[model samples]
Target: MSNSVNLDDIIISKRALHLSENSSLDEMADALQVQQRGVWPLYDDNAKGLEQVQVKTFHYAQCNVKVQFNPARIKSSAAKVDNKSIKERKCFLCTDALPPKQKGIPFNDEYLVLVNPYPIFPRHLTIPRLEHAPQFIEPYFRDMLELSRALKSYTVFYNGPKCGASAPDHMHFQAGNKGFLPVETEYSKLKATTDRKLFSNEHLEIFAVSNYLRKFIAIESDEMTLLQTAFEWLYELLEQRGQEPEPMLNILSGYENGKWRVLVFPRDKHRPDQYFAEGDENILLSPASVDFGGVCITPQEKDFKMIKAADLIDIFAQVSVTDSYFDELCAAYAKRVVE
Candidate 1:
């Protein structure tokens, strides 16, 4: 850590340095891959995870949902995040516990941008807080947006502690190389087809996309202050509705052409019944931000091979906010906008 370093300074200097050195995300990704290959056997083993993964796509309700059989993710997909379990394990995101060779770029002088050993995208990064902090988002979402802007070629996402964060004990966000998720391509169509605009001003545009299989609210703005204010308003509303600590949600953010697009999925359930189901009915599918964004991860081959369009629709219905609830939230938001 340097005394002269600040968020703006880090953003400007790091991107300038990296752009001069690597020129593009692909080159930087290759550098990370090379580094991981040299020191991280786990990463090398899981980089091979893509090879063993079998992918199947299904068109459900006009949305293309892809299921991937990723056995290497079983440990994460089935982690017991109960208090007892979390307390027993060493916090892997902690700097001291990190592998010696795992290097990272400084972020805001309070976080580190490191390559994710287990990746869902070809180039995935885990940005964890320098201090061991409980997984929380509202306080650091502005930072997430800044990271997205700095990365430019990647989409940043956050999984709530209970919703999908494997390291629930630590505050972190992940970035994946753009163009990986179906949601990125389908979003434009979704806005036109299913999303209902809830708020629009010079500074921001907010839309609720409930009919898009998974219900979520999308906010876009070029100004961080406006976006942050809107998010806080939504947070307060959800909290008043009794979502403790914070609303159970997952977020996906992307920055391009001077606009930051953020999608927030409000959740009522953690894992669906199929996760706890017996024998043949069991599917280890966990609905994370990426899952809500259209790519579902199935850690078991059988589940991946067997999950159908109807099953996906059902899983989404079970995990996402109910249609009625989403409708109510949208209505409330619309009314607030009008008032």
Candidate 2:
């Protein structure tokens, strides 16, 4: 299917711009929020859901995980992303398929940043490519870096096709207000004390954070090219070990203090067995970058209230790569960097 909608057709031109030619993406996004709330009733209602959302925190030795009871996220948490189901449904991320009232800010004539109607953060933005494409990160990882820098106040994240993307066939990245996730605050502490250093130099540093409930690789650098090169190497390493078309992983990135910090959450499965379990056993929780970052989303209130620390441990264990595999991958990457 073709994304036939023109850039001019969906760009929030009038009020969002304030007649300014140099409005930053962050400013434009704020403007889009105001315009969307007034013009889009569905978004307005869901945006209000953020207020009623309940949260409970579970503390671990090294970090804490927050479970958000967000009823508005049922559409995404329970999204049917199977190949057959995906083929039958229209692509919602496509510009032509968006609601009439929905509008966005065009980025470098490549992506359209639109307000997410079903939000998990106080301010949520969904940035989708202009063309219809599969959800893959390698080719667009640099774009993510650029977006994070451009929207400095937001954390840009990617949910792999099988990792957490509801629309697995579409290419998109999501941005939420910074500090919404626990990792944004906890990562520095982990890095200083417990995280295992894989590689480091003047331009780039990579560390493996295995103590966190979910295992992830952290890449940090002040230079964009160096960061991108390190990520590409890591991507190749992941591809060599995985059977999937693309290595199963979710990425969370942010730009602050003239540097980019990227976290890669490698996955072994999309959802835990609890997701498919019968009635009382079923916990409708589908983890994405936010979840890995420590704010686990539970669409159903029952799951929210009943989910315990042990259950989260079990879920993370089931979805994340095994400890042995993770260690081996880290070792291999560390060795490769030196050679």
Candidate 3:
């Protein structure tokens, strides 16, 4: 799945080149509003949802989880993920198929960063590879870290092919305004309460977040090489447990103060059973990278109205890896890496 287009041939605007890295991305988002008619209409949809959106905030000792009813996300929430169904549709991410008004900034000669029409955050973006490819993180984890650094006001995230990615056939990442997800603000507090240190070295430290209700691993480092190595090791450990092309996981990364902080959510399932339940029990909730980051989106009003804190707890527990497996994996991680 490769496209023949050469990234260098793509012309980026002179204004895009003159602005600072972070400012350039901000301007691109702003330009999308005036350049693309679809942007604000969708934003208006978000505003409408916010007004009518039912929300339930679960109180936990570690952090609070916010669930929002956003009907605009139904397409993504209940996307047809089967290979046949995927093949039947046009690849929307492809440049030739993109909306005429949509424009993007060339990123590192391999990706195009564009504003996302259906936004989960106040400001959201989707960055896709020039060539079509499967969604995998190992090859691009370092790039995610770099993007996080370049867009200092945003957090970069990845959704695995079997995770929440709607365009599983295209290698891509997403960026959202910082502080939108509770995880960004609650990480340090959660770390203090839940950190299970696996390995520590001069520049890199790895910890498994044990008490955050969902299973996740955190990697922090000032050195990209060291962080990449540790991340690969973690990937391998998770990969060995399953036979998939890559492990089922989602990633969130942020960089500040000369260091990168990455959180990995290991998943055992995509949609929870409630999504498939009979009439009265069915919920249109699908967990994604943002969900793991503490904001769950439900595209149906009924689902949002009926869902409770306990239901959310159950959904997370069912999708995330079991506690015992996480503990064993952490112990193995400690032994696999030498400080």
Candidate 4:
């Protein structure tokens, strides 16, 4: 992948919005509307796909999860992320490879924000780096925070290369409308009820949440530096557990009222055994940040209709770290932060 592609070749002048440190939510909302209207035919078709989408909510003891039967997401759900497959295919996220009808808003001179055609949210944006790079969060976690703040109407999220990312060869972050995910609305109550405080300071507070089907660490802060430091620390700790290239994780970040809330879901595997199972036992689910956040996407209508709450519990358990490991991680994190 070459970084020599000119920005003008990809950006539609009329649709492009200037994003900066002081960009406002209203400005982004307007830009998104303009872009959608500018690419009317494509978005209009995607709107029809959205209309076909169906949802079913399963109630759990501590929380509820919505399973969406979105047939348009089959490409992403069944993506071949293996090295050979990735090498043979073109990176769809690259500037030159983008669809002819697609237009983007230039952000911070480094990223381009484009509307997602196969969307789970009513308003979804995929932000990819202008330069082609591998998916890795260590170097760009700060960028995620800034994007969440600038795109205040959206929640910014990352899916690890080996986990949920379809274009693992390209570096990207996705943003969807705020309050769209169940976890966003449930976080405050979960924090007060089930989350165990791991660390706290004047600028940052960290908590480990285990009751949410999947185990995860949550960091809340009004300061970017503190948030970055805490995230990097957690990344290092997870890395020490021996995953190659990078640790397996998915993240969801949101900014509101001058504060940033980041949820990190560490994974032990990409997909559960059910994904590879044959015949009637098979499921096509590939869990990602959104899935961990409370809405799981099922590309096959049969899988969606047949999946039960017990299946969800088993799937989450198979992909997430064990309860004992989570306990140890919490203890270690608490001790390390105080030191």
Please report, in order, the local distance difference test score of every candidate based on alpha carbons. 0.81, 0.90, 0.81, 0.87
What are the clash counts of all predictions, listed in order? 0, 0, 0, 0
Candidate 3 regions exceeding 4 Å error are 1-54
Task: Name the candidate that leads on lDDT.
Answer: 2
Q: Once model 4 is optimally superposed onto the true structure by TM-score, how far is the C-alpha of residue 162 displaced, in angstroms?
A: 1.0
Ranking by lDDT: 2, 4, 1, 3
Residue 175, candidate 4: alpha-carbon lDDT: 89
- Model 1 Cα shift for residue 195 (angstroms): 5.5
Q: lDDT by residue for model 3 over 1-339, one digit each (tens)?
A: 225543434435646445454465556555553444444465556544555666678898777999987777898889987789889998888776665455677778788887777777766788888777778887888888778877777889999888899988788999988998988988887667754888877898888886787889999999988888889888889988874768989899988889999999999998899989989889888899999999999998888888888888899998899989898889888888874
TM values, all candidates? 0.90, 0.97, 0.90, 0.94
Candidate 3 worst ten-residue window by lDDT = 1-10
- Candidate 4 lDDT over residue span 1-339, tens digit each: 356666676665532555564656536655764566556676767667887789999998878899999888899999999999999998899887877777777888989888887888888889999888999999999999999888888999999998899999899999888888999888888888865898877788899889789998999999999889888888878998898669999999999999999999989999999999999999999999999999999999999989999999999999999999889888888887787
What's the C-alpha lDDT at position 177 in model 3?
A: 83
Per-residue error at 131 for model 2, in Å?
A: 0.3
Instruction: Name the TM-score of candidate 3.
Output: 0.90
RMSD of each: 4.1, 1.3, 2.9, 2.3
lDDT preference between candidates 1 and 2, better one: 2
Residues 68-118 of candidate 2: C-alpha lDDT, one tens digit per residue: 999989999999999999999999998889988898888988899999999
